[model samples]
Every structure is written in structure tokens, then in C-alpha cells.
Target: MKQNITDLSVLELSNLIKSKSISCTEVTDSFLRHIDDLNPQINAFCDIFHESAVRDAKLADAAIAQGHYSSPLHGIPIGLKDLTPTSGSTTTFGSKLFKTNMPEHDAILVERLRKKGAIIVGKTNTPEFGHKGVTDNLIFGKTRNPWNLTKVAGGSSGGSAAAVAARMVPIAEGSDGAGSIRIPAALCGVVGFKPSFGRIPDVAGPFSSTTPFFHNGPISRNVHDSFIFYRAMAGEDHRDPFSIPTNSSQPTKPLPPLNRLKIAYSRKLDYFQVSADVENCLDATIARLSNLGYQVEEVDLGLGLDVEECFMTLWRFKLSSTYGGLKKNELHLLEPTVQQLISEGNKITPAKYGRAIKVRERVWDIISRLFSNYDFLVCPTTSVPAFDIDKESPRRINGIEINSLIGWFLTYPFNLTGNPAISLPVGFCTSGLPVGMQVIGQRLDDTRLLQFSETIELENQWRS
Candidate 1:
């Protein structure tokens, strides 16, 4: 009967529930208390399902009392990113137009969660349609960082990252098209895992079917909970053509031996200029991992990765293809930034988008060759630490101009490469703000990534 159980990892809580040390109702109540008290300031949740969550918790407790256990996630509370739809819950997608949107059925991932008996706590906020890097949206205002409420939590999975960092929920679902999960995780000081594309099947809305960039992943305070939650939701779904069978690719594989690891550590990944504070912090983390005999070495990507042109071209095309066709009258419903993005997207030529696709393939080839020699690749997750919540994004970095809101992020290139990447809280800046180091694994080798990440986590002792 710990009074402050909100901080316990999901695995610990699951064990407690199994042993009857704490009823599911009690677990639910502890988090609800935190949500009621902290959520007002964090703005992490757009909707909190207190009544339904309690009902579900009681059901979970009764199941356990009857000598039954659904899964490790049973009785564990988690938040679904607003981009995902859950039956009987508002799937706002963090948009004003969909403010009253409620889906008749849960997304495939949500259905899997219910099967695992996870308690659905609420919907975490996101940028409308997960458009930008920063988390603020017109529908529900902004989600602030828990580490320092004045600083912005990176997005479009901003709410999920903030909620996990704030301990509003032990785990929250996050979607990444272009560093949506890793960006927020880095800013908020949490573990955000974006499994290799297709590892977790997405809802695959019309536009989603057209691209392979979007991913459904997990955000949490630790590696163990993330891997567990990922296993529960990861499997083939008929609805998602891109879905991979869990049996064919076990994300639960054991960690490889440390002596066998040949990791590539890059400070800037070749193009971005990392802030002085962030660079210093990453240098310390790399040194620590080096001393631990991880066989790490610094290497430049050499791939001319101001990849903004190719990536953003595809981004605009994706946006235009997805939102450009929406009825003209409905355009007013979007936030101004998103509306502007859609407008720019509509202007992209088919010729330009095609060239960008070719560039993406070339980028993947380069990364693939590098992975052939390295067990893992590491770098600072974002070039800068968390910025002000009031601004759209850092307009400049190291006195140089940034092309877009996401220009400062180092996590997006991996998104383009379809690699399993993660953000682990490594160190804090002079102002006490957290900095994250990104690690990417071979394509479809998520298990190895988590194993290596666990090693790094143990070495660094990351705390939000």
C-alpha cells in the first residue's frame, strides 16, 4: 500500500496486482489522483476517462481474484495518443474540426490493448494530424513540460511524452511520422521507442496507407515497460497491410553480448549544429558508454543530411495528399500553421515529390551500409534542448537559419530511414532541462535496440 505509487514502473505494478498487494482499483486511483492534481498544469490529457477507467480496473481486479490473468499489461494504466481512435472515446486527432469526433470502434492497436486488459486512462494531446514538431494545437491549447512547465514539450506526441514524464501514466501510445515520438521524448525526459516501421500496425487511415513513415510506438519512464507494452500491441492485423507478424520477428529477443557490440557514435549526424549545452552533455554520455566497454566510436554520417529538402518535400506531399483534398470550407477548422503547411503541400509538384522519394531511397542505402559495420548508431536526439512553449519552434540555431519547425531535430532522419530508434534521457543542462541521446538499430531489429537501450539506461540511470 505505497502512498505514492504513481512512480512505480508498469512491470512492478503488474507484479503487485498479480500478488494482490494492490488492487487494480487502488492502482487506478493513485494515477487518477496525480492526473487530477498535475494534469491541469501539464495539459497532457485532452480527455480523462475516470469513470470508465475505474470500472475497467474493478473488472481487472475481479479477473485476478478469480485466478485469471489476461496479460502483463492487465490492470496497467496507459494513455493513447489522440491520433489513435478508441471506441466510445473522442479521437480528436488534436484538431478543432474533429473536436466532437468519436469512433465506433477502437483502432487495431487499441483493440490489442483491450485484449491485454490494459486500463485506458485517457487521450494524450498532439498537433492536429500530427503535423509539426511542437505540441501546441488549436483544439486543446498546449501541453507543457513537467520538468520545467515553462519549456515546450516536443511533439506531435508532445502530450504522451509530457504525461509519461509527469507520471500521469506509466506508458502512453505515440505515433511518429517525422520524429513525433522521439522529439517529445527527448524534450520531456522519457523513454520514447519507435519500433521499426510496420512493427506496430497503425490504424492506416486513407492517407496512412499511402506512406510507410507513420509508426505506432510507446513512451515510458523505462525500457522494460516499453518493451512489454510494445509486445502486447505488436502483431499482424488484417486491416493494416504493412503489419508484420510478431512470431516471424520476435521483438522480445535477448540482448546481445556487450563485447560483440560495435556502435557508431555521431555528435551531429553530419549536418545539424548541436547547441553547446547539448553537445557537452552528449559528449559525457558517450564517454560513460565508452568506459563501460561498449566498443563505441565517433563517426560522421558523411551523407549530406541537411535532409530537410528531401524529407520536407515528402512531408508536404504527404500533407497535401492527406489534407489538401479536404473541402475548402473545412480548411478554416485547422490551426494556422497546419493550414499553411497544407497550402505549401498543395503547391509541391509531382516531379519534385518523386525526386524526394528517390533521395529517401538513397538515404536508406547509405544507412544500410553503415549498419553493416555497426551494431548501433547514436547521437543527440535533438540539436537543442527544450525551447519556449510560446514560440512555434526555435527560429535559428548557432546563428544559422532553420528551414522549418523540425529543422533542429536529429531524430527525423531515422524516421526517413525506417529504423528502430529511441530517445533516452542522458543528462540535464545548466538550467536543469533534460537532454536525450538517440540510438538507432538495424531495420526490423527492434529487440536488439531495446536490449542495447536497457544497457544504456542502466549505465546512465535516467530519471525524469
Candidate 2:
């Protein structure tokens, strides 16, 4: 039987389109139809532009017929997290405050994706202002895991991850701040790559110049697909001053054999709590790496339990500084979690924020030292599998009280240190939900990270 268009990877679909064996319209229709059938229950997308998507796909088909193949993303249907602004489209940052807000220009990544011939299908849902780790908001409700409806899809890229997991799109744009992209990718059993800071120019909207922890990235079912998106979006734009100005994304050297690579493994990043099933899956993954002839050794990161405290300090301040100017009525319209964040941000003194910066430097020192000895660091992406969709985050893990905000998150430290990290769906929990294994590389070494992840993807053949 011929495989469904929606089931094929981005490269597969691109080949089919490039060869004229299948038109872009057919592929777009397949995905739109699939979205029509599945999106109601999954609630992965807050907006679906059926007419414009078909129009764009038809344009792509016309271009391909004229012998124009833009890139691997050509003619592919992709979802943008609602937080990503699209010119002339309603780009609600998952908050009612911006429900009708439309931008006059696309975000740098969005512009790049379009220039590469990728069609934007619609905007995926996200938590209000993407302030939390769960995908629930006043505007779009909650996005549920495609693996299990009762479980969350993860956030703030939850909608993008869920859309990719459900095969509604082969790949989608996701942003990571405290693992927003990686968190959802892990929960939805997809690949999410958080490139080293500024690998992808993020110049637009309120965050155009303010934050460094936040990253614009990609989510897909496999590493190769994510790599394609990364290459298309990576590179410096004059607009984002922090954007890395180099051709470092292109790999210059071939990868060394797996046997020659040393991988550092940590089950828990110090004080984080992980559930039993996730722990088991993580152990099995490490053993698989060992059996693959890779030297995998357990290590104590010694990041200390207070890591989350410092992270929250920086996060809250960012939130407060960004949205603290809202009028009283506007504040009430914001998500309670976001309002709380702004309130918390107000309490953060300049000295406390300064301390957080010092803590970030410490994190960088520790992770940098680890990378000096090991080629990569591997760990569970999230401390637990998907949890209840309605809750902001789990109050406890393994029956122990944890911080409700980001306590279960194991991804923020890398974000803090601006390391390149990718999440691959390694295995499943006892309850049949997926578990992700995170791979971290030295700063600005995104190319090597993708190569390593592709190796593992080939070995394990993970798919949503």
C-alpha cells in the first residue's frame, strides 16, 4: 500500500513533490484533512488557515513546476506556535489581550521559513504569553497529548508539538524558554531542537531584544526534519544584535564513530524529582547507548537544588519587565499564571536579578567544564511523562512536593547556559506515554548535536 502523505517525513514529501510524483496541493490537502479529522479532540491548533494554506501550496506547486526548489521545506505544511507573529494573520500570544492583534511583519524565523517555500498552515495554541510549561490559556483552552487525551501536550510549544506528533504537519516552529519547545516535544514524542542562543535570529515583537534565555527553534517527528528547519532558520540577522554572525551551523568535519564519543549521563540534575517509569526508560536508553559502543558514564552535575530558584528569578523578571506595563483591566484579562508571573516579577529586586545572572554564569561554568571532558550530556528531557491537561504543572513528582511552576523541568539549566540541546523521544513509560532523552552539546555546536541526534534516530527509529 502507498503510504499516506501525512505519514511521510519532510524529506520524503519534498522528494515526492520535487519529482512531480505528487503535487504540493495533494500534500497540503492531506494534512488539512487530517487536521479536520483530529484537531477537534487534540485541540492542537488555535487557528487553521485552510484557504490561504491551499493557496500557498498551489503557489509552491507552480514554483516547483518552473524548476524552482527552494529547500527541503519547500511545499511542506508547517504550524507556527501562536507566539510567533505572522504578518496579516492573527498572532495571539495565547492571551486574550492579543486575540485580535495582527502584526505588520513576520518574525525573522517566519520570514525565513516562507522564503524557503514552507507553507504556514495555522497558528498552534500556547499558554498565555507562554509563561508556563503547560499548554492552556484563556483564548484556546488546553492542548491535549495525542498519545493520551487526559495528559497534556506540554507547553508553550504544546500545540506545535501535538500537531507534529499527530502528523497534521511534518514539522512546526517552536520557541524554548525554560524548555517550552523541548518539553512539548518530549511529551508528544517528537524531536525539538533548542539551538545555542542566537543561532536563530529572534527579532520581532516585545522580546526582540530583551531576553537571552528564550530561543526560537523547531519541532518535528525526527531529527533530520528538525535539522532542515534549523538550517533554514539559523544565521544572523542584522536586526537581532545578539544573533551569532557566523557560518558555524554548517558542519565542517564528519562525525567521529560512536565508539569514540564519550557521553555524560545524569538521571536527575541534582534536586529534580523523576517518576519511576521515566527513570526506568532513561536507564534503558543509557544502556542502549552503552551497547552501541559509546562510552556512557553517569555523572553528578552538582547544579544544586536551588537552580530552579535562580531560574525563576530571571524568568519572573523577564515576564514582569515585558508585561508589567499592562493597565489594570488588561492585567485581569491575562492568564492567572501570567498575572502571577508579573506579580512575582514586581517583587524581584535589581539585586536579586543580578544574583540570577551570577547563577547563570555558574551554570555555564559547570556545564562548560563537563563538555570539556565529554562530547555530549544526556538526560531525561522532562522529569515526568505528560500529566493532567488542565493543571499548570504537577504539584508533586514521585509523591514529593515540588515547585508547581518548573520544578519537574530538567531543561532550563541548558537554557540558562545557552547550550545547544535537542530532545529525542527515546522510549515509552509503563502507561504507554512517550519519554524523551535530551542531548546537550557545547554552545554554538548545534550542527554536531543534530548529527549525533540523527545517529540515534537512525538506530532507534523513533516516530510519533
Candidate 3:
């Protein structure tokens, strides 16, 4: 039972702890042991709060004994992405610039996690300032994939996904600006969920992005744990004007049988090139859904604007505006890739920025109306499967050139539309890397999408 505790899902662990069948200390120790053994190879953690986690676990046990349960996540060990602020803990955004920085208070979401009695075990790694989709940063080095140590773990939430996949933690917090959460989850073979915009608050800090598309969410081994963590961190916070009021009492219903549902499936978003493996995996997944009784049809979402140009224009401008005030030394501290983006952003005039926003709004208007006819949409999370850790970006997909960062990120459009999207590990490639299917639901239909994901997960019996 002790040996198996570390493998249990967050829901299972909560049940065990609540039933007194297991102590929080025992659960924490089991995870600690797993991290100790696996983390050296994966480099998933920047720091491990072994003592603090054990102490908190003991306190959770005492509270349970006294008939006081904090929340669903009580006593569960979790890891925070280093970008999320943690009071007194080293919260480097995988950058040398913040090596000595510590926050005086936890972010609003972190405070909520604490209120729910979750024991934060450590901080996961990210790219410097989460600038790119890979997790290597100057501060704590790179976070490698657990499936194959030599391969790259998709980032900037790479460390979080790797930790969850390697069973270092049952669940971990991850922030996604442009497929940061889903990308890593796809590569590391776990579940990554990015809820609707404003579903989770982005706390006030230097690392926080002003763009509505940026979000903080969760990465976990399974859908149920993802749901649990999402619930724990969601709700309105005065700290973030964008935070939405949540109805916790709203029940999540299982998805209607696939035969009763209409889904729009597309490999390429009209013009983007999809790798052969990605194309095959998506094709097989669509067929599987059809077999399970879903009406799967190929449809092109004529996203009128050049998605890459529009997204990069906006993304770069936001980064430049946010970090432009830094001194020369601070600017030089940024990675070359990030520095290049900032420079590009600086060149965009205010008129161009406004036009980009207009383009985004128009695109969202088109996609939302399309969702009216379909229950959900499906696509490949990335244009290609996991690539070499050293390569900044794959030059081509299925022998077609990928023009820019957003071209490789096929999943960011939904984020721009403020819709809830999830990445489910559907199959593995010939190289043994995992393939993920993006399950996107209509705006504010997060619960339905998650329930559908669980059904698909069960039907396919996909285990990582």
C-alpha cells in the first residue's frame, strides 16, 4: 500500500487520506522518495521543500484527526511553477536575474492552495521569463523529458509536466501563455488543462502578463486530478480585475455519447503544415472518436489573418512594454531569443498594435460562431512531435517550412478566443514520444469538455 500510494491519482490520495487509511506524512514521504530517485535525471524541480512538506503533512493529519478537513486538496503534495510567487521560497522564473529574489506574499492562487491545505513540495522549472516553449533557462539549467531523458520537454511548463509524468507530484501548477501547459503535457505524456480566460487569477507581479491570453492552470497525470486542482485555484480575486466569479455548485456531467455529438476535426488550420506522425495520430484519434459514436467531420476554420504574425506582434509588444523599462544590465540578462523578441516588439507602432488586437477580435468572432454548429473542435497540439532539446524550433513539419513560433503552436488560437482547451495523450509516435489531441470546448463550457475528455480517456485506456 505504501509503495502504491505514490502512484495514486490526486482524487484517490484524497480519499485515502480522508478515510484515515493513509497519513499525509506517508503520502509526502512516498513522493519525496520518488522525487529523490527520479529528479536527478529529469531536473524537474529547482528546489524540494522536504522538511516543510513533511511538517505540513503532519499538520494535515492532525487536522483530519480533529474532524477538520480543509478542502479536496488537503494534504496533497503539489509543485508550483517557479513563475508563480511563493513567499520565502526561491521563485526564480528560471532566470539568473531573480536568483536571490523572494516574494513577501504568495500569489492569490497560491494563497487559495494553502487555504485548501495543499502541501507545496517545490518549484518547477521554466524558460527564462517563459519566453519560449522549451524549459532550459540560465538559472537552473534545462528540464528533460521523463519519457526519454535525451529529448526536450515542451515548455515553459516543461518541468511541471515532467514532474507529474514521472510521478514526482500528483499535480503541479503551470502557466500557459502560448501553449506552455499543453505543449509540455503533449511532450511529457500527461494531462494539461488551460481553463477559459480569467478562470484562474494571474496575480500581481513582475512576471505576470497583462495580456488576456496568458493564463495559469494545472498539469497532472490524469483528467480528474486536473479538474480537482482547477477547482481549488479558481474563483474571483480582487487582486486580478480579470478574475471571474465561479459557481462551485455547478455539477459537471459526462459528455453525451460521441454519436450524439458533432465534432470538427482539422489537421492543419487551413494552411499550417502538420508532421506525418501528428497527421497520422490525429487521423487515428478522429477515427477512434467516430468508432465511439461521434460525428467526426473535417472542416477548415478559415482563420482569416496570418495567425503567426498577428500573435507574435501582440505577444512581442506585450513583452516589450512589460520589460522595456529594465536597465541595460537587466536587458542584457535576458536570453538572446527573448531579447530578439523584445527588439521586434519595440519596432511595432501603436497603430500596428491596435490593428493586431482588431485582428484577434475578428478571429475570435469567427471561431465562436463556428462552435455554435459543433460541440467541440479537435487539432494537433503542436505541428510536430517532441524534437531535439538543442533545436530552438523545428524548421519544418512534414517537409513544409514552419515560418515562426506561432506556426509551430497550433493550439494558441483557442487561447486567444478565451475558450477552454485540454491536451490528452492519445497515442505514441514511432520515436516513442507521445502524441496529444487538443480537445477544445465552447467558451465557458469547460466542465463539459473536461467530462468528455475523461470519457475519451476511459474509452481509449490511455495511460502514461
TM-score of each: 0.96, 0.97, 0.96
- 1-464 per-residue lDDT for model 2 (tens digits): 19988999999988888888999899999999999999999999999999999999999999998899899889999999898889979998988898999888999888899999999999999998787788988888989999999999998899999999999999999998889999999999999999988888874542533344788899998888888889999888878877885485565566678788999999898778988889999898888889989999999987986678788888888888888999999999987778998998999988988888887888889998998899999989999999877555788888999998888879989878888999999989989999999999989888888999988888787752
Superposed Cα RMSD, model 1:
1.7
What would the per-residue lDDT of candidate 1 be over residues 1-464, giving only the tens digit for each residue?
A: 54479989999999988889889999999898899999999899999999999999999998998999989899999999999989898998888888999899889889989989999999998988898888878878899999888889989999999999998999999999888999999999999999988788877573454354888899999998999999998988777777788776334556557767899988888888789999999999988887877788789776675377888777777777778888877998887877888899889887988888887887798899998899899999998888888765777889988765777888777778889999999999888999999999998888888988998998897752
> For each candidate, what is the lDDT?
0.87, 0.88, 0.85
Best candidate, lDDT: 2
User: lDDT score of model 3?
Assistant: 0.85
Candidate 3 residue-wise lDDT, 210-292, digit = tens: 45387888899889899999999999987778788768566655566657788998777777778888888889888888987
Count of backbone clashes, every candidate in sequence: 0, 0, 3
Rank ordering of all candidates by TM-score, starting from the highest: 2, 1, 3
Q: Which of the two, 1 or 2, has more lDDT?
A: 2
Q: What TM-score does prediction 3 earn? A: 0.96
